[model samples]
Structures are given as C-alpha cells and as structure tokens.
Target: MDAPFSMYGPDFPFAYDHWLKHPEGLGRIPVNRHGAKVAIIGAGIAGLVCGYELMRMGLRPVFYESGQLGGRLRSASFEGAEHMIAELGGMRFPTSSRSFYHYLDLMNLKTAPFPNPLTPAAGSTVIELEGERFYAKTLSDLPPIFQEVAQAYDSALEEGAHFSSLQAAIQRRDPNAIKAIWNPLVKAWDERTFYDFITTSKAFRHLSFRHREIFGQVGFGTGGWDSDFSNTMLEILRVNVTACDTDQHLVIGGVEQLPKRLWSHEPEDLSYWPNGTSLQKLNQGAPRPGAAKLFRDPEGLYVTDRRGHTDRFDAIVCTCQSWLLTTAIDTQESLFSQPLWMALDRTRYMQSAKTFVMVDRPFWKDRHPETGEDLMSMTLTDRLTRGTYLFDHGPDQPGVMCLSYSWMSDALKVLPLDAEKRTELALSALSKIYPDVDIKSHIRSNPITVSWENDPNFLGAFKGALPGHYRYNHRMYGHFMQQTLSPDHKGVFLAGDDISWTPAWAEGAVQTALNAVWGVMNHFGGQSSLANPGPGDVYPVWGPIDLDELS
Candidate 1:
C-alpha cells in the first residue's frame, strides 16, 4: 500500500503517475490557467515535483531556494573522490514507496538492495551489547534469547494491532474491512506512544527487561526503535503495516538525483511555455534567492527574497520545512489562520547524525583469524556509535563506510565535534568490536560528518509526531481539500513530507505535493471528469479517518 490509511483502494494506493495520466486528472486544469505563474518555495523534491506537474498543466512555476537545490536528500562527496558519495540524508527507500519509484524509473536511476539486517545484501550481521559480541549469518544463527525476542515482536504486531487481518484487508482493497480495522486503531493508539505499545502489550510484558532492552537496541528491520520510542504508536504502526522498514533499496550515486532530474527535464508536447520548457529554464537557469518574507497584497501573494528582490504570483506553494515559516521567513499573520499556524508551529522534527569515511579497501570483509567470522558486515551496537554500515564498491576500488549513524540523544552526542574529532570518537568506539582490525590504517581521506539538527536550513531532520498530535496532523494533511479549509488558507498550500501521514519518507512528500497540485488547479476553476476523477475528487470517500469525530 502507498499509505496505511489512504482513501484510495488499497490496491491503488499511491499510484501517483496513474492519477496524473488519467483523463480526469490531466483535463482538470482550465486552458485559461496557461501562462499563469505559481511561486514554489524550496527546491526540494516536493517543490520540484509540484512545479514539474504544474508546468505540464500549462502553468509557469518560479522557484525560490534558500540553500542547496536538494533539501534533505543531500549527498556529499570527498574532495578528490566524487564517485564515492556519502549520503547524509534519506539513505534508503523501501519498495512500498511505489509512487516515489515512478520518478526513479522515469529518471532511469540505478539502485541496489540496501544492507538492512538479515537481508541478503547484509552478508552477515554483528550484534554487540554489554561487552558481548554475537555474530550471525542469518536470523536463525542468533542465540535462542534473540530469536525469542524476534518472535515476540512478530506476535505482538498481530495480536495487539490485528496486523495480519489488516494486511489481508489492504491486499484485497476491502474498504469496509479496512475502516473496521484501522479506524479503531487511530482512536486507540493516537493517544499512546511507541514505548507504551511495547511495554503494555502482553507479548512483550512477559519478556525480561534484558530481552526488551536488546530488542530496543537492535530492532528487526533497520536498527533500533529506542530513537522513536517516544513517538506516537500510530507512526510506528504505519511503518510496520506498510512495510516501509523492509526490502529497501538505495539510489545509486545519491537520492538527490531524482529532484535534480525533475528540475531540468522537459515533458513532451506543448504547454503555455513551449515544448522545451523546464523549471531550470523557466527560472533563468537558477532559482531566485531564498524566500525571506511572505505577505499578501491586493493583486496576489508576494514573496521577498533574501536579496530584497520581490515577486508576486497568483498562488504560492510553501514546500520548505514547516519550522521555517515561523523562524526563518517573516510570514504575514493573516496568510494562514491561527489553528493552522498552531499545527505548523507544533510540528516536531527528529534529530539525526551521520559520519562517513572513505577507506583504502573493504578490509571489513576479511575473516577474523581466530573466530572464523567476517570482521563485520553490518554492525549494530549499544556503544556510543549506534550503527555502522560498509559499502563495498568493488574488491579493488576504495570502499565507503558510514562509521556512525545515530538519532536523537545519540545524534546530539556528536553535534559539538568536527568531522576529524567525530571520526576519532567513532573509531575509538568501534575498536571494541574489532580489536584485531586496524580500521585507522585503511582510512584514505578525511571523514565527512553531519548533524542535521544543527543545520540552519533544516532545524531538524524530519517530523516525528508525538502522542495527542493527531488533531494537528489531521489539519495539516487535510489542508489541500479546499472546501474544508478557511479562505485565508486557500492561496497558500503546504507540501512536504512532514505534513504527510508517513513523515520522513519521499513517498509522503510526493503524495502531499500531488494534493497541493490538485488544490492549486481547483483554485483556478478546474474540475476533474466523472469517469477518471483526480485524487481530490475521490479523496473525501477514501481519505484518512476523521479523528475529529473520534475526539
């Protein structure tokens, strides 16, 4: 499924390109809208995708970028070695993100299976905790205690949340069954946190504290759940039911390529601009400076850039991180209503950090002379360094290693250190796992590190909704259905992953951008045909459960 609780038939969930190609979707925009200008703030994927589709609908999109072109999908390369890149943001994407794959397929970007735990790509896994090391080539190779913990997790997913029933219902696209199973979940779990679900569930309650601690430190699919323990149960459920945590793949080179391609690619046939028109060309080969302030005028919405240059457009799509509206940009109070402003302001973002180093070779592949085990395939530990990943380019070519990947408290730990210091700290921690391997000797270049929480362009990595935040999420996610919104919110639309049902994923960003596109088209007197209605036309019937009534 594209999203856990989408209004669309579960089978048809997140078929974004299908909706765009449908006669009703394509025909919704009025011909008169041709040549009309729309301002898109932030050159991220959401903004770029929205602009790309809007241009196809015969509207001109002028863009504003405050920082680099590819917002959170950042990929940094070493000074001399450009081929070996370190992904600082959005490293892996699951297969369930079908809507996002549309762009990847369109771009013909290469991909390889990500080395998630127990996956084939992760040749082996080493779990280290409390001065003990356990190496496993597969899940079965682990000790019985670990196996029991994994089983308990699976059972909890089914018994506590009706995981199996819901999965079957979604597979069959049974709307009635979906509502029956999912609606109650929203009401019950919305007020609870992930930790609450784990501890309160009978399956986990029976286990010892050590078992629970191990489960928290080395989670099944990705790594750990401790970072997200305080987030709402609904958020974790969404990740599980939709399978966003498994069967993931990494974009070759970098995830940033998707948006960069959309920025320059010109669709076939004619719109108002011309056959060869693209967002890059429309903006005169570069985006206007970052939007510094926004205010409404008699003619339309006005945006003033950091350089004091101002531009006016009929409508504005604010795709920047929500926090920027309140902190970075000076937005007029009247632009959005108070409750909407509250929702935006309350959007909580999670902190994340990553440190990467290029090594002379894939020395990690060497078997430990004494243990007969591979030094480390993918390492997960409870040390200062949470997770470490190794990327083997080739046997001879230099390898890239993500020395340390952490979140929340762990992320904050290295915020004060520079790249060299961060590398030293990571190496010190990793030495405990592989004392025989001289990791420092294999290092070829200076390490690259990032603390997303400290980056000025993004206050934090992505939104992590807390318990009791459903009402706020409801307002933000449903803002595109114009009839339900106030007049003040009509001219300005929000489009970003943070506003979506599944935050921090590119699919959510794409889905919300499409919602904003439909809203903008409707604002200019567009309508979807009855037979092949756009997402907006069918959203009321198939959309998210109304938490307001439950409240």
Candidate 2:
C-alpha cells in the first residue's frame, strides 16, 4: 500500500531521497564563486558531508578539527587486530535513512542486518527486568505482559498522535496531509513528556505500572526507552513515524569508514574540480588544527585554530555539538542573534557509555546440555548493564561483544570508572543473569570503553529534547533560512543530528547536512536544477510549522 519506509518528514515533508537520486545533480555556483572557501568545523559525518558535497560543487571547504576525523561514528580496533572493532557510537541505522544510504551505497560499503533484540538477526533475545528473566525468539514467545505492552504502545500511537494517518501521509510524501495531522500534534504535545504520554494514554493506563516498566526496558527497534522517558513526547513520536527503530543495519567494516572514504574518495562527476580531486588532497592529507575562536570582522568571518593560525572564509558550517560554541570555543556573541544563541545554549545532550571486548569465537551460540537454549543471547536488562549485544564475525575468526551499553543515569554510574573496571562491573552483572556461564574464561583481549561526556570535544553522545524545547529545536533547525536574518548571523550555519527532529540517529545528521549544503549554495547565489528540485526549492511550501507566542 505504502512505498518502502522513508523519513520524509512529518515536519519538513520534502523528498530528499528523490532529490539525491535525480539525474540533474544538486546545483552549480556562478563560475566566479566556484572557488569560494567555506570553513567547516569538526570532522564528523556532518562536517565531512558538508565538505564532500561542497567539493563536488567546486567550492573549497576548509575543515577544522580538535579530535578524531569520525566524530560520533567512532570505531576502535583491538590492539593488534585490524577489523575487530567495537562501535562506540551510531550502531543501528534504519532503512528509512535514505539520504544516509545514498552516501553509503555511493561509497560501495557493505551492510548486514543489525542484531536488534527479538529480531531474526539476533536469533534469540533475553530480556531480564526487575529480577525476572525471559528468553524469546520473537515478541510472541515472551509472556503475556510483553505482548500487552507491545499492543498498548501501538494503540496509544493511534489514539494520541493519529500515527497511522500521519505515517501514511509521510509514506505517500503528502505534505498537505502530513502537516494537517502533525501540526496540531506539535501544539498539543510540545509541553508533554514521553512518560506523561504513557501514563495518560488509555492504552498504557489500562495495564499495570509493570507494563510501562517492562516496555521501557525493551522498546521496539532498539534496546530500551527508559533512558528517553523524560524526553518530549514530540521527539518520541518523530522516531516512531519515521521508522527509525525498524529495519536497521550496520556497516560491516565500521561506520567510521563512511567519513574516511568520503574524505579520500573522488567523485566521478564534477562541476569545476577535476575528477581526481578529493577532500583529502585539498586539505593536504589532514585537517587544520582544532578551532579555538571564531569572530566576524570587517573583512569576513575569521576562524582561529588551536595553534593560533587564523583563516578567513566567506561562509562557515559548524557541525560540532552546539555546546562547544560556549564551553570549548571563544565564539563571539555577535555571531548569532540572542534567540538563536539561546537555542544553542539551551540544547540538551544525553550521556552514553559503552564497553566492548573481543572474544575467542562465537561461543555464545553454544547451547546447553540440560536444555537447548543458547548459552547467552542478545540481552536487555534492568541491571547496571542495561543492554548487552553479541557480534559474531564468523565461526572461524574471533567475535565481538558489547559487554555493556547504557545511557542517561545508567551511563553516569560508570563515567568515573576505567575500561578494566567498567568491564569487570559488566561481567559481574552478566554473571548474575547467566550464573552458569563464566564469561571471563572466553575473553581474549583487553576491554575498550568510551564515556563521551568525559571527552571535552563531545560534551555528550547526542541530544534528547525535553518538554517546551520544541521552539529551541525549531529555531536551530530553521536558522539556515538566513535570508531574513541580519548580516552577522547569515553566513555561519549549524548542522548536526542534534539540530534534527530525530536526534541521535545518523539520518538526522545526513538530512541536516544536506540542508546546510542547500543553504550554502543559496548564500553563494546559486539555485537547484529545475529537473530535480532540492529541499530548498520545496522548503518554503513544506518547511516545519511555526509556533509563535500568539499561538
């Protein structure tokens, strides 16, 4: 009935996928403006992508990085092992992320279904919460309460958000229909929390509090929703409508490869740059040192690196976490309006910690003699180690295990611990759930761990918007339409998953980067091809709704 699932926006309902797939190409700048330099801060997916697309348009994008090239798409390899890596961030990417997939396929990388809980790829899942454990091959295999929880969430979506109709409109790419249903929701739910939605809904209220608790531990498409309970209901609804939690997959080599390849890979088609030209060659093999200060002067916008080397550009794209503007960098207050600055300062990010280890082999697949159950399974629990995922490389080679993956308060518990200590704490918790299995006996390498909040470059893993913060998100997201802004705030742009409706998801990063590309092109006095309209072309008619004081 509906087309293949896509995140076409219940907010800004534009077809970015079609725009990317079109034959006419994104657009072209005036011949005189072809070599204009745009400074891109941070080398994350957003920064790298902004660089890549601008490179294709023949504009020079100078990158400034304070840390690793791949920001949140971090993958750490074992000491000696080449490909045995632990994904530190952005593991499960949903199929609905067509914009991201466009680049993924262009790079010619491979993907396999992610091992999400209760999915076929996982083979089996074990959910342990409140001291009770259950093994299930699918949702039906779980006890009645699990099924009740699942059904109740579906019913609540229909009751509170008109999810079916809204999703159908998105699937159809029907802007008018989507806006009709979604705009009202923004008004009604902008001030409500995700926990409030669950408690107030008849679907969830009909069941006991245990139903809500169990559902939080094992939510659809991913590990847990408990970490997101305090977030705004509008944020949660966007994830659901976009299918951000379903049909997910992972890059086999590692997600970091996405940025790595894009940096070095040269596109066959080019407007002004030569075919062999790449972002890497342009930057002379590495990015400039980390940025320490940014200010606007009479000449243009000036970006100062950590080494005090300063460079000026006509435009700039800031792809780092917004907080960096205040905490890490000496950004001039005049660079943005007070309202826009408020949105950036007010943006919230959630903490995340992951501890991973390389094992001898896929030993977890080994079955018990007493019963045919797996020795261990992809786990979801209420303990300190909230979610543990198993990765099987092959029967012959070694395997990878995410000993513990947690967020919010759970992440803070291990924020102060070292890698070894975190691993020990995780193994201790797993032993409680799988008492018979000596998980330590199978270990083959030292543990690798990350607490993003501990890293000054990245204050937190990603954003989690709270109630009444929708306006902040709106202000940051739509600021790219800088035509109406004063001269000072027009050139610098913000682009990241944090600025997107679906925070923490890679698609959000991809979509917003594309939006920044459009804004930059327009800033340079360029327009999209008439044959295939870009987001900017359709944005005026399909942009996100405006919620003002009068409303």
Task: State which candidate has the highest lDDT.
Answer: 2
Cα-based lDDT for every prediction = 0.84, 0.91
User: In terms of TM-score, how similar is model 1 to the real structure?
Assistant: 0.96
Clash pairs, candidate 2, are none
lDDT of 2 by residue, 1-551 (tens): 66677899988988888888888888888889998999999999999888898899889999999999989999889988878989999888999998899889999988999999999999899998877889988999999888998899999999999999999888888889999999999999999999999999999987998889887888867978989999999999999999998889999989889999999999988788987999999899999999999999999999999999999999999999999999999999999999989999999999999999999999999997777899999999989899999999999999999999999999999999999999999999999999989889999999999999999999999999999998999999987788888997889998999998888998898889988999999999988999977787887888888889547
Span of ten consecutive residues with least summed lDDT in model 2: 542-551
lDDT of 1 at 255: 85
lDDT of 1 by residue, 1-551 (tens): 33433223231243455675565445456787788889999998899888888887888899999899978888888879998889988989987776688788877898899987777888888889998988887889999998888898888889888988887776555767877888788889898999889888888998999888988999899988899999999888888877789888999888888888988898774446677888899889999999999999777889999999998889999999999998999999998888889999999999999999999888888888888888777999999889999888889989999999999999998899999999999999999988888899999999999898898888899999999888888788878887766666678988999988888888888888988888888888876667666767777776777777855
* Distance from true location, Cα of 207 in model 2, Å: 1.1
- Where does the lowest 10-residue lDDT sum fall in candidate 1? 4-13
Q: For every model shown, what is its TM-score relative to the native structure? A: 0.96, 0.99
Q: Itemize residue pairs with steric clashes in candidate 1.
A: 7-542, 7-543
lDDT of 1 at 81: 94
